[model samples]
Target: MPFGDFQKSSKDIQLLSEHILAAECEVPGSGYNHSEMDLDNCLGDDNGNFQWGGRNFHSHAHNIIFHPDEGVAHVPVLRADLDGGSKQSNVNLGERIGNVNGHLVFRW
Candidate 1:
């Protein structure tokens, strides 16, 4: 497959996973507990965000990716789950320092 097609397909799969995660919840009287669903393993936290390509993504949910029309080539993301749950945060983008050891690095 061509690279663009492969990339698009990959994004489609990711989007599907995000949908499944969003629709997942405890079903009352269904004899299945939330733990039984094992959805926690697929998420990094309660925000339904997951880690991929060394960045945080939420598909159609809250995420840190700068879109092409945003005019910014990249934006640094820093996530913190204060109050033991996901909350809105103000972030500042730092200088990109490229990748290191399979990890994306930035200079603050």
Candidate 2:
């Protein structure tokens, strides 16, 4: 199978974001960019404000970012593997993205 086959497209991701952020999803979230780290929950955001955490299962790269920077007209996904798949690296990545949207949007 092609590696790209497993990759998530911008549209797919957008829908996923919408689904995940939906109030009816039953998953409590801190909006798009707002995040809070909790040891119990295994989420490490350092209290900066991150909406979600993404990890490349194959590469072990950690990614955590906020709302897409619509104003910037670009979508950015911060990936960190400096610590060798360390969960804390995800938190660092989120801090870099800050609270903003990118080019990718649900409506194209």
Candidate 3:
């Protein structure tokens, strides 16, 4: 079979796992929770806003089931959820982080 045809055929009969992970740098000593910052705080007294400096981290996992007989090449039927938290500085100027949890489900 041609390379393209072989590739296509292989894709048609496999269960695949896909994952994405990302992270950013946090502001030094800026320990803040997402819920604590509001419009007022974000927008400083001078209307100059102080944006959240903490890095946002995210991850996603997917399980793709392929069914060639049904004419469906791939179907993503599994997922994972994630959550996280942190703590502020001793001076109370920063914010606090919280807990993180994740849930995974697979559809058979």
Reference-based TM-score, model 2:
0.19
Q: Write the per-residue lDDT of candidate 1 for residues 1-108, one digit (tens) a residue.
A: 211111111111112232221112223344322211112233233333333322322322443332211125333233333223365432222222222222223322
Q: Quantify all predictions' global Cα lDDT against the true fold.
A: 0.26, 0.26, 0.20
Candidate 3, 1-108: lDDT as tens digits: 211111121222222232211112122255322221121112111111112232211121112122322325332121222232122111011122111211111111
List the candidates ranked by lDDT, beginning with the highest.
Answer: 1, 2, 3
In candidate 2, residue 30 scores what lDDT? 30
- lDDT minimum window of 10 residues, candidate 2: 18-27
15-90 per-residue lDDT for model 2 (tens digits): 1321221111111243233222221122223333222443222233234333332224344233333333334332
Error of 3 at 65 (Å): 2.7
- Which window of 10 residues has the lowest lDDT sum in candidate 1? 3-12
- List, in order, the clash count of every candidate structure: 0, 11, 5
Candidate 2's C-alpha runs over 4 A off are 1-59, 85-108
List TM-scores for all candidates, in order. Answer: 0.19, 0.19, 0.16
